[model samples]
Target chain A: MGTRDRIVAAADQVINELGLVRATTREIARAAGCSEALLYKHFSRKEDLFLAVLLERMPALTPAVTRLSGQVGFATVAENLEEFARAAIAFYRRSLPLSAGLLAERSLLEGFRAMLAETGGGPHLPIMMLGTYLRDEQKIGRVGADADPDAAAALLMGACFHRAVLAALVDLGPDDKAPGFVATLMAGLGPR
Target chain B: MGTRDRIVAAADQVINELGLVRATTREIARAAGCSEALLYKHFSRKEDLFLAVLLERMPALTPAVTRLSGQVGFATVAENLEEFARAAIAFYRRSLPLSAGLLAERSLLEGFRAMLAETGGGPHLPIMMLGTYLRDEQKIGRVGADADPDAAAALLMGACFHRAVLAALVDLGPDDKAPGFVATLMAGLGPR
Candidate 1:
């Protein structure tokens, strides 16, 4: 692969092992089989590399969310949401460990928050993106006009996120509960 | 209050400020204005003291949940669930910072898991309690007979949790979104 991709993959592995606060860029560069100078050529800050790992190597929630905008009127609302829920659950589950350290340290959390804010990112992205999708669907009579898109997005995504949080504490096994969650939500979102 | 209550209160404050791992029994005792030996008399272990703080000093979710069983046939299911959601959001928000330490370190998380297992407790209590309430409602035809009570319970509680998680990173302000969330879910929950 390319040097940039290698560096990002190495960052993910080291960060997963040592957490964000403890994982050093030098270790990441060594893991990538490159010099620190070479690593700096591609990404200047550790946060930049971390962001690359998040947006690239983490579960594909952003891409799936991006695709929602295109599927506005093409699919059943329930089906679209079910797909989103599955992706969200997987994403949250994969990313929870990375966040354990960030959330534990006050300064780390503040820096992470600033990094996210600077990039126009944070945990709120999915909610806003999906809310926009729901609003677009509403325009086409595919969704109930009175439905509160943002709140519905929050509820649906929040349920997936909660499942991930619980899974972090215990084994939730192979059972897939997202479909049932989306179906129940669909009962409320149907055009009225 | 009494000495026992004083220790529990001190533990709650200390743990909230310093997290679960770093907040020691000594510090907690000092905060309570008591000796270490006296602190041990009221609570045999720090875990016991932490549990007491969670149950007694945090937001009253346990009591609100216990009250649900008695309201099986009395109130609207939507109203009951909404009340539970508010209590849960408050409870989760309060307990999250305390958990930051437990979840961040591998050994600490393992110890916490063991402690929770020994006490027959973890994060599953609320889901089980609310699910039982829904089942009871179903027996009286207050809820749909075919509804998956556990999934519904998980979704409602998870949404509350997700809201708290977001509020942790960014201010969600004074606006209450729990009611709208419950309203949407209730549309599906109402007995046909």
Candidate 2:
């Protein structure tokens, strides 16, 4: 692997273990088997390196969008929603520790925000994407005409996001409600 | 206020401004106009002082429970859920920064976790309480038999929690979806 890749991997590992503050550049360099000076040569500061790590490690949304698009008209709406929920839940679980660390540091948080702004990213984008998918289902008469797509998306994604948060705070097990929950929602959403 | 109360207030203010690591004992004591020794005497450590402030300032659940209990049979289910969502969202908004600060530090996070365990507290207790309320509504033919009360509770609480998390990450504004969101969920949950 390239020096940059190794360094980024090392930083991710160290940060997950020791958190952002204690995941010193020195430890990251040692783990990457490079000199600390070499680490600085590649990335001027820890924050820059952390950003690199995030782009590489944070789950990309493109595949998920494509997957959901394919399911809207082709699959049963419940099956599609369940598949979407699994992907969203897994992404959130991976995202928690990474984001909590960045949000805890104001400087890092500002830098991260700047990047998102430059990329035209908004936090609500995911919810909007999910809403779009629900709208497609609605068009096909799979979802109730009375249901607000955005609110339904929020309800589903919100549950997944919140579950991840609680898991971070304390050990929480799977609720075994995924299948049942989707079934119930679909029952209400199906044509009246 | 008493010396102890004064010290606690100063510590809360400093911690909120400077975060957990930078809120030094001396700084807090100076802000409180008390000797560092007296601060220590009142609270053995900063964590203890933090806990006191949390109890005093954090949004309490008593009022919410009382309000919800009164609404079980009287108000429309939609009204009760909307009212509950408002309270949960407000509490989560207030709690985001405080918990993020503590979670940033491993030692402090462990200390806080230990305290929760000793107090016989679980993160899902509030959700469970909401579930119980829904079950009662189900008994009265308000909620659909198909909707799992626990899952319904998770859905509502999860959205509020997730919204708070996103707001903490970046600037998020009032969604104005609370009322509509509750209405949509109730439509799906109403007897089919």
Candidate 3:
């Protein structure tokens, strides 16, 4: 619709076609039916443009963050956790393969990480949210008193993300493992 | 070493600098102190060279698989699982960053998947082996009978891999979470 949207869309296409290494700004500009100068008017750098594409294209973890925030005390601890994990798993399944294009390119990943660091963010955003929720559960005596919330949160998110990776790379199909996995993960950690 | 090893090492270097997209065969050959013809004689395609690099450079899961095989009947189930997870985590920490190069390129990744298929292997081989070990544990009444060995295996490996990704991308440093995480994971699974 707009030039900016068109440029971003074109960048996405070029990335999908040639991978991140070959998706030059010139190629992206050509795809957008614009001059390179025009493309630079919207974004200062190629990494900036790539960042826009990534943020716009990848599913945001914010909605789940919001849901976890609201469900802190009301739901069963296991229920709250399993649901949160399910949301993460779904997001990873969709984004993992697509995000490979960036992962393969060192500079793009570094730029992305720098951008994250500037924003006081990193990949652990989801883990932190889950940690907060788990801490709340521990406080209220829903989860085990001895359980380390940070480690539990990391373990939960890590497993979900890993499962997503398997689904993407190994043709593992849609996740039928979550319910059992969650139960296995949660079995020993209930209030004692 | 020999020409084959030299070529693969050169590919590793070029890939580290330029990522997969820009690491052309010409560049790799130049770096390897060999003619492109000599390089081709050693490896037919770029993907093959990269695979050789991956196989040589990245940590093989085979040793851990062997360790688990022998430990099935001897060690405490929790101890065995934690050690296996540590090995997986250590491997991921080394390989995850290097893997970004593959994730960036579509054809390269597809080529990789095809190669794995030909070898009757995929990334989840370790998970499957661990699952077998856990099943052995279940049969002997060491772990909970209700636990899904496959899911448990997936969860263990998945969590370790995700943590490695974080360490590489998010500056998460060394993993201080594993001991507590493993404890939480094994809490209810032990024989009473």
Candidate 4:
């Protein structure tokens, strides 16, 4: 593997073990078998490295959500939503620890927010994308006419996100309910 | 206020400002105008003080949820749930920062789990209570027989939790959709 990939892999391991707040860049470099200077040469900051690890090593919902806009009229809405909800729950479980660290400290939260501002990236991205997809479905007369796209998006994503949050806070083994949740929601969201 | 109440209030302020993990007992005692000995006398542990703050200072969903089971056949299901959802959302927003610090460090999380075990207290209590309430409603035929109460409870509380989480992570002012979300879910959960 190349230097960048090696560094990201090392970061993924270190962060998962020590969490995002406690995982030092020095330790990550040592894990990667590289010096701190070399690590800095590849990534501008620790946050950049963390972001790379999240994107490269973790399951991301962005790809699936992006693909959803194209499936507006092809499949049943319930089936499509259940698939998306399942993928989103998995993504959230992986990403929560990485992001939870940002909330633990004030400066870290601000720095992370600033980084997101620079990159035009934040947690709101997925919700916005999902809302747009629902809107597209609405245009095709697949989603109900009076459904609030933004509210529906928030509810769907929020449910998935909460399931991950609960699992992280406590032991919720085999408590997966994404499919049933989607089914119940789709029943309410059926075309008018 | 008495010494115990004073300590609890002071701990609330300190924990809110410095977060739960960083707020030292010394700082809390100083804020309360009491010696560390006096603080320790009043509260055996910092976690106890944090719990007191959560139960005493912050809004709690327990009372609302507890009252819900008694109201099974009284009001419209949608209205009752919307009220509960709003309260849960508000409670989650207040309690999130306090609980989030525990997840940042491994030792803190372990300490918290141990504390919860001793007290038989954890995050699952609300979901269990809500699920029981839903079952009561199902018995009265106010809720559909096919509905999964546990899943419904998780989705309802989870959506509220995620709304708070999202707002904490980003700027989402006036994005409150608890009423509409309840309306949508209730449409699916109506009596068969």
What ranking of all candidate models by DockQ puts the best one first? 3, 2, 4, 1
> Per-residue lDDT tens digits of candidate 1, residues A1-192?
999999999988887776555677789999999999999999987667777887888887988898888897786888888888899999887777566666766665676777776766788878999989988887887776667777778878888988887776766577888788876665642122
lDDT for each residue of candidate 3 in A107-142, tens digit (9 for 90 to 100): 777877787678767678788888887777777777
- Candidate 1 fraction of reference contacts recovered: 0.38
Question: Worst lDDT window (10 residues) for model 1 chain A?
Answer: A183-192
lDDT digits (tens) for residues B69-164 of candidate 3:
888668677777777778888888666645656665677777867776777766788889888988887777777777777767777777788887
Q: Which scores higher on DockQ, 1 or 2?
A: 2
DockQ of every predicted complex: 0.37, 0.45, 0.47, 0.40
Order the candidates by TM-score, highest first. 4, 3, 2, 1
The CAPRI-style docking tier of model 1 reads acceptable
Candidate 4 lDDT over residue span B1-192, tens digit each:
899999988888887788766778999999999999999987787667777888888887888887787788888877788889999999988887776776766676776677887887778789888888878888878777777677677777877888887777666777557787777666642112
lDDT of all predictions: 0.78, 0.74, 0.74, 0.78
Cα lDDT of model 1 by residue, B3-93, tens digit = 9999999988887777665678899999999999999998886667767777788877889899888898887887887788888988888
Which of candidates 1 and 3 reaches a greater lDDT? 1
True contacts kept of 4: 0.40
User: Which regions in candidate 3 have their CA more than 4 angstroms from the true location?
Assistant: A1-6, A30-35, A188-192, B188-192
Model 2's alpha-carbon lDDT is 0.74
Preferred candidate (lDDT higher): 3 or 4: 4
